[model samples]
Target: MTDPQIERKLIEIMRIINESDRPVGARIIADELRNRGYNLGERAVRYHLRILDERGFTEKHGYTGRSITLKGKDELEEALIGDRLDFVITRIEDLIYRTDYDPVKKQGNVIVNVSYVDKDDFEKTAGLMRGAVDYSISPRVGVFEEDSEDIFVPAGKVGIATVCSITFDGILLRHGIPVKPNFGGILSVENNEPVVFKDLISYRGTSIDPIKIFLMRQSTSVTGLLQSGSGTILANMRSIPQSAVGDASLLFQQLHESDIGGLLAMDNESGNVLGAPVDVGLSGIVVSAGVNALAVVEEYGIDVTTRPVSTIMDYGTMKTL
Candidate 1:
């Protein structure tokens, strides 16, 4: 048989054994394969099982069923990684809005806002003009200097609003604010980085307090993600709710307030998208925090399953913050 075909059967058998607390026989294996759309028979399965036992991938207990060995587990995980023939692209971004716009020139135009950025602090302050690059935003800088009872607004400064402009559906900002946001670890979903809430940004809806706190935890974990690499994230989730979140920029504002180190979220496809605002065009998503994100999800009685990654919705793309 072809190596790939043999490898496929081996991985499937390993998974069955791993999932089962007790030993499984060849007949059971054949039945399971048939249920999954494979048409292998018990005789064929036994033939392969004999080969597996020879390699120590399967341990046959005389008349009893068979179980997978440690080597089999390693082989399965390796196969999972190798089976990643495709990737879901997620574009990373920062909390942003157009800060540089002439109210006199482009008044009452549509503006877009997002809640995560990949640039460092102060770097975006100067170069974050309109269309600086693919994802950079141009917003007015609002520099404030309090003079006794009076307020002084300077031309450009960090963490301040500078210009006056109208925002439409997408949220064009006169004073655009971008905060430092981050995430760590990748949810191995097929071959793509996972996206939540259509943009990987999460916000409100049903137990928002705890969920917001969870997002903060992962965001702070970005730098410490073990053996992590940089990748661009772009999200495109369906049915983003605007009412749950008011302003998209505020989501990052809270993330900054939480002082998150980086991003560590999404084991795979997630329904929880955190840190979104109302009326910023993008919608809100609820996320959970903790080392076991799935456990947190299950605590709320949400059904979780492991399926082929192709079934998930297209969220957004992302980059290292």
Candidate 2:
């Protein structure tokens, strides 16, 4: 059998060609491979294209020298899921002054506050955001956000964060805007395990135009980060709306603001943060809620929130709990 790695590469090449709106040439594919630090020659790329055609993954056009096929699209979608792509969406809020203000030199800054979720969930949310952006204003460029910290694993964790940027013709106009003809397909796992997905979209403004303008600014900021070697992940993701009752919007906010090791203080009445436990040694903490529980304030009584509290630990230096 052919090496799985080599087959994977061939599949990736086909996917790239299919995902591209315009038909791409073999030379262009070869150049892209070279830019990615691969020593793939144009002849080798052409050979792979022929192989793909034989396998029914791609087809050559009658008159045009370029080609694309449904098989190619399916292969590309599979690759996108396997790779676990990362993306970012920024909402811009432009503050216009009543009097004369320099629009060019001085501009209002729009901060896109990001909340953490599972990698799959993040991709799904990003896809929806991209669709909104595409349908609203048709943005020419976009920014990418990189994962700076290590992936949170149960045991023996390593420091490696995947990030990437994609430039497409789209812009997300409003906060509560709904996506038409949703592109977010079936979100499933290889082992058939259930996964949690959340969508967090926020905007604080009166005018929609200024918000759209601010989105452009925020996109620029994210773009800058991607260009500066901070964002490094693949493109192509699925978009889903925030409609489920179990979305953990508030908890995510608390996690983002609190210190890495701080305790998650819960409010009994509102189920929100009354305050966190400071200077308290925590062994470990597990935050959980209902599968579709939206209002976590009172549901904490019915749901589950568990954590390990450490007692009698020396704090001056590193000591065992």
Candidate 3:
């Protein structure tokens, strides 16, 4: 097998190409290596490029240049997460604290506070909580609609929304209940009835409140690329909801048919898409964030999560937020 260090260098090259948002030549890449203090030669760079092409990480653009493939983007994402992967793996070390009080009912409840990295970390941690907690759990992802005061899901129970921050060590720090709201309420899902503040608490302070708190960690990384502008991309295969699979598949098809030139498929339940096999007639892939569906655009190979806006009608009142 190739040396792991060489693999890392190749991944760095892929990242630079992807970030550039356009094709690049080896001379530029060689110069970049020189600036980084690496004593690599043009021939060495070409060798690595050939290996990447063979592995489907990159492809020749036309005659003289090359660009990143969908597989390249996926590999680069994994590579960038080096060391940071601990943030996700060490989630077990995180903790969620809970307490509750029912002043009006003359009974106390439980409130669970999860300490984690940030909003994304909070969401991933919530997924972990679903498995840890004995009670039934549901996970949802979306931004609060404009003009809406709160995030809501029809017929769903409200739970505590913890504010999370990231430590330099990649630990997720969470601050629980009494979360301040600007216009909308806390991050709890809204039901038909107003999702009152107390609703977000874990327990009503009755008896030793049965509420439980759990924590899961999310890992994020920010790495520089050569020509591509700076941006954020979420990588995971399990986070995709089962209910959204069809939409996700259709979005993949749309992307494959577009000018971006790439393919996408559900790699696993985590919402991560492995590099899809595509004809060599197309360009490379670029993966990024989206809405309800994981979108794979062709030519550019941009993977975006987006729900078909038209699919909104298929949803029932029970599904509306």
Candidate 4:
């Protein structure tokens, strides 16, 4: 086998072993490999198994079979990193399908972004978050202290779960409207109103979260917006079918009245929204990014670790911050 082919086969074998509940034998490994269209014979499987053992990527259990080691798992993840380039958009779609939040009835789970800050900075973090320039999904937030298990809070760190704007997509899906997230951008704001997009990262093209990249660069001026009503803030652009425009508008109004509003602007008639063009037959929408509040905290020079579009949480657990 060529070098590349050898690596691929070894990685596949490790994956099979990692997925099995018990030690996996060469015969089963060969069968599983065949199911994946590898066409590897039992002899080839045993040859790869020996290579894996020599590399300390697998362990022999006397007569049982072989199991993947921690080193093997690490290697697998590194090898498959290229396959995860579209992980962000994939995760968002999955969450959208899982979203069951209802605006009118006000129940069910919604998606949220999780951030961790030092416990010593918790009070200050809350204060900064409260000044998010009104670009967040909603005023509701979930706070998990150091000892809380609802979400992982590292030692001496407090976890803050902020409402993700993707909740809008989920809500719309529940109402028969499909949403396609296009990109995340730094939206210019003037006099507390959204203007043009200053910079954008296509959701379909990147591996890392765009908002996280922006925050790390300190590229957002959320504090400026809060103080002077003009600056750049994180925002996401999405599209819906033009046929659903009217119904979507009414539903968004109901959402606002229900205090779950996040819709910033919708452009169906013009097909141009803040300098970003919408495709034909689709209406463009710009919604507030969920991690904007966390960005506010970061702006204050307080350290924060953010995980955007992180998890689903019960709506009832969130309270006004």
Candidate 5:
């Protein structure tokens, strides 16, 4: 076949077109590609569109641009499967005998890596395993995806961020949000009341004109949106209610105090991006929850404008474990 990378991009383009409500031009497709971590141009995207059209995977509507066909849909699903199987099978082999499985619980942790590190340094760090399990060694068996408790990051400049677990990732993926590791600015926006529903509807606050905010359990809202960079997108992200959960400021506080990495909310119905929020992280972002993108590099905080604002690390899936 063609180079795997090219083949992947061809499928990716097909996938993007498949997800859109209407036919989208190459520019919009290219923008979506970049948001999902592909650095490509509209010209390059159109080239692939042409190839897909030739393959009968995409169809053009005069000047309305292209959309994916049924054959393309089948191809995309197969692509997602083929892309992940190798890694999943390898990780499975690594922990074939070490994990606890429950078909009912569906909870399990895979031993992804065994590495040596400074023992003193690991404990000094917050939000780690801490006293949860027995330690006493320089080598760490690192493969617990996340901690059970919610991690709270203080509000500040660029150094701050809202981290979510794989549990949260699946929710957004089921929504319109693409399931991929990504980092980008909100391109534009149209503000409205936020909701807790994955359907991207079902209101929480009616009189709260402008912001129909709610406490987001499954998804997250990063301060760095509105400059979505892509075309107008109806964004449904994870967010917290304006009121803290009991004494807990929760994730919403991070978005509110954002001098950097914070919530850039989007209205899902209108499909219009709202105005971009100011740099709550003009100084930086705080790690408000979970692990993964835990620390803030110095240069990144200086000015998150060009990039490194909010970060997301895609966690692998769970199989019967």
Candidate 6:
């Protein structure tokens, strides 16, 4: 077999063994491989097992079969790293396709960004989030108790879900308007007006969410924006065909009327959106980032772990911030 083919089979074999509760035999591993569409025979599986044993990735249990070792687990994680590249954009596209939100009636499942905060800081976090309502994708927010069944909240931590801006893309798509997400960036704001994107990370390039990266680097001055209207904030850019601009505008207005507002700027007749150049035949659309509220909580020295475009939730369940 070619090196790539052998590597794939070995990875699959290790995965099968890792998932089993007890040591797995070659016959069982071979059967599972076939179930997963790999037609490896028991003998081939045993051969691979010997290789794993030699490499100290697996330990043979006298006649009981074999178990994956700690080394094996680490290797597996490292090997799968390449598969995670561009995962952020893939997740965004998947959520957009899964969205069934109806802005006109404002009653359907919509995308949300999840955050975890210490239970003791929940009230403070909520208040801080309220201060940045103007910069969030929607005023509606969902708070889950530490023991809430709706979402998994870590021990002593509360889960907060915010509306993601991708909901706009989904809404436009429902109306036959296709939208292409461009990037997530830090937008410089002065006097409560957005100036330009100071830095941009294309959605197609990175595995980690750009907003999350910026937050980790302490790159935001959201507190300044909240106090003096001059600081950097998180934002996203999208592109839509020029012909659908009229329809998109009408939908955006309806969305605003429904209490969902994140529209920052759109391309004008000159094909420039807030000083950002747009491609021919397409208009660029910029909107407030969903995680901006979480950024505020972080600025206060409260710990927060954000999952962007994490999951979908009923719009009615969220309470206005």
Worst 10 contiguous positions by lDDT, candidate 2: 162-171
Residue-wise C-alpha lDDT for candidate 3, range 242-298, written one tens digit per residue: 444454445344423321111212333422223322222222121221110111111
In terms of lDDT, the poorest run of 10 residues in model 4 is 146-155
Candidate 2 lands at a TM-score of 0.29
Write down the worst ten-residue block by lDDT for model 5: 132-141
lDDT of 1 by residue, 1-321 (tens): 548667667666776667565788777677656533356888988888888888888888787799888987777666644342311111111112322323333332222221211123234423322221211112222222322111211112222221110121112233332221222122322222333232232312211122223333333222212114322222222223343233433543433332211222312223334322223333422222222222222233333221111010101111112
- Pitting candidate 3 against candidate 5, the one with the higher lDDT is 5
Q: Best candidate, lDDT-wise?
A: 6
- Report the Cα lDDT for candidate 5: 0.35
| Number of the top TM-score candidate | 6
TM-scores for the candidates: 0.33, 0.29, 0.27, 0.76, 0.33, 0.77
Q: Which lDDT value does model 6 have at 216?
A: 80
User: Please, what's the RMSD in Å of model 6?
Assistant: 7.6
Count of clashing residue pairs in every prediction: 76, 21, 52, 0, 48, 0
Model 4 segments more than 4 A misplaced: 1-79
Better of 3 and 5 by TM-score: 5
Deviation of model 1 at 197, angstroms: 1.6
Off by over 4 Å in 6: 1-81, 269-272, 275-277
**Whole-model Cα lDDT per candidate?**
0.34, 0.29, 0.31, 0.82, 0.35, 0.83
Q: Tell me how candidate 3 scores on lDDT.
A: 0.31
